[model samples]
Target: MKLKNILIVVNDIELAKKFYHDLFGLEVLLDSDGNVIMTEGLVLQDEKIWCEFVNKDIVHKNNSIELYFEEKDIEAFVEKLEKLYPKVEYVNHLMTYSWGQKVVRFYDLDGNLIEVRTPL
Candidate 1:
């Protein structure tokens, strides 16, 4: 068996699509009604549908998983993120590790954790 796309629940499908595209450059590969498949194998599902399927309350900031992305210019990415989404809650601002890898961690619009780091 092969691993498929990573699915995340979003309260607003259209807003989620635009958020992912604006921040991560992920375009919609397909829009299947309540489900949207985007580039890099990311899937956005409607929150109502997700809750019904899981039969549980949706929790935000669970911190169980994070979608990671690598960028050549992490500083520019962080600036863009701030300019575009000022209200974003950051787990950590851009910081460099001892090994010189810079990373920024923040939550997406729907509370999905995201970490953007400079290429190692």
Candidate 2:
């Protein structure tokens, strides 16, 4: 079976919304009740990722996921992110990992790790 949308649990929905919006330029396809739907083809499938925010602490703590973006202008992408959300600097800072991928790792407001990388 193919994987559909992935759920990212966060403590603060509004903050997470702003973070992802600034980082990926994602559109809010659906926003009703307490749920928000983000569409950007984050995964290969024709699926829309969902980020559900709850008042409780994250069910899965210290968890991270890496999303490899095929960016033609890496520098510009990084600059745009930095300008919008300075707090994400820790989550999106540039570094070379042992796997030889240049990545920027940082956490959402609720502590979910997010990495944007360019594999070498």
Candidate 3:
């Protein structure tokens, strides 16, 4: 068995696609109705479709899981994030670990937590 994709529920599929593309350069590989498959095996499913299939309420900012990305220039990434989405809620404003890794955590427009960290 292998992990093929990591799916996340989003309130707005278009906005989620744009968010991932604008920030991390992830392009859509396929768009199947309410489900969109993007580069890096990330899948975006519309909240309505997901809730119907799962028969449960959708939860945002549960803080149970987060999407992580690595960047050599995390500082520039953070700067762009601020410029593009001023209303974005941050989990932290750029912090460096004792091991010299810099990271910043924030919630996307849909309240999906994400962490951008320097490459190890």
Candidate 4:
């Protein structure tokens, strides 16, 4: 089966929406109480509801996984990100890998790891 979407558990839906929209320019496809679906198959769900549904405690800052996005112009994207969010935590600041693709990593508002990279 083809992959569908990624659901992120968020502490606040409005805050997540603003962050994703302002930074990545994702448009809201659907918005309701405690849930929002944005462009590119990104879904934000309330953490309390998520935890209740999954029967597990909400965990933050788990750095084991990352949401990755490919950018056409990584440098330009980095410039915009830096200008808009100067205090964002960066795991790696604009580095080229051995494969020749440039990438930058950072944490989201809720400490989820996100990476943007240029195609090799």
Model 3 per-residue lDDT tens digits across residues 40-118: 9999999999999999998889999999999999889988999988899999999999999999999999888999999
Question: What is the C-alpha lDDT profile of model 1 across 1-120, one tens digit per residue?
Answer: 988899999999999999999988999989998999999999999999999999999998999999999999888898889999999999999999999999999999989999999988
Q: For each predicted model, how many residue pairs clash, with residues at least 3 apart or on different chains? A: 0, 2, 0, 0
Top candidate (lDDT): 3
Clashing pairs in 4: none
- Winner on lDDT between 2 and 4 is 4
- Estimate the overall C-alpha local distance difference test score of candidate 2: 0.58
Off by over 4 Å in 4: none
Candidate 4 residue lDDT tens string, 1-120: 997789998998998898888878999999988888899999999998899899998778789889998998989988988887888898899999888989999998888899998976
Whole-model lDDT per candidate: 0.94, 0.58, 0.95, 0.89
Model 2, residue pairs in steric clash: 91-105, 91-106
Q: Return the clash pairs for model 3, or none.
A: none
Model 3 worst lDDT run, 10 consecutive residues: 78-87
- Once superposed on the true structure, which residue ranges of model 2 sit more than 4 Å away at CA? 41-61, 64-70, 89-92, 96-101
TM-score of candidate 4 against the unseen true structure: 0.90
Weakest 10 consecutive residues, lDDT, candidate 4?
Answer: 57-66
Q: Residue 117 of model 3: what lDDT?
A: 95
lDDT of 2 by residue, 25-119 (tens): 77777765546677763322111223222333334335546444545556676788677766653744676668866766666565566666774
Q: Which one wins by TM-score: 2 or 3?
A: 3
Q: Estimate the lDDT of model 4.
A: 0.89
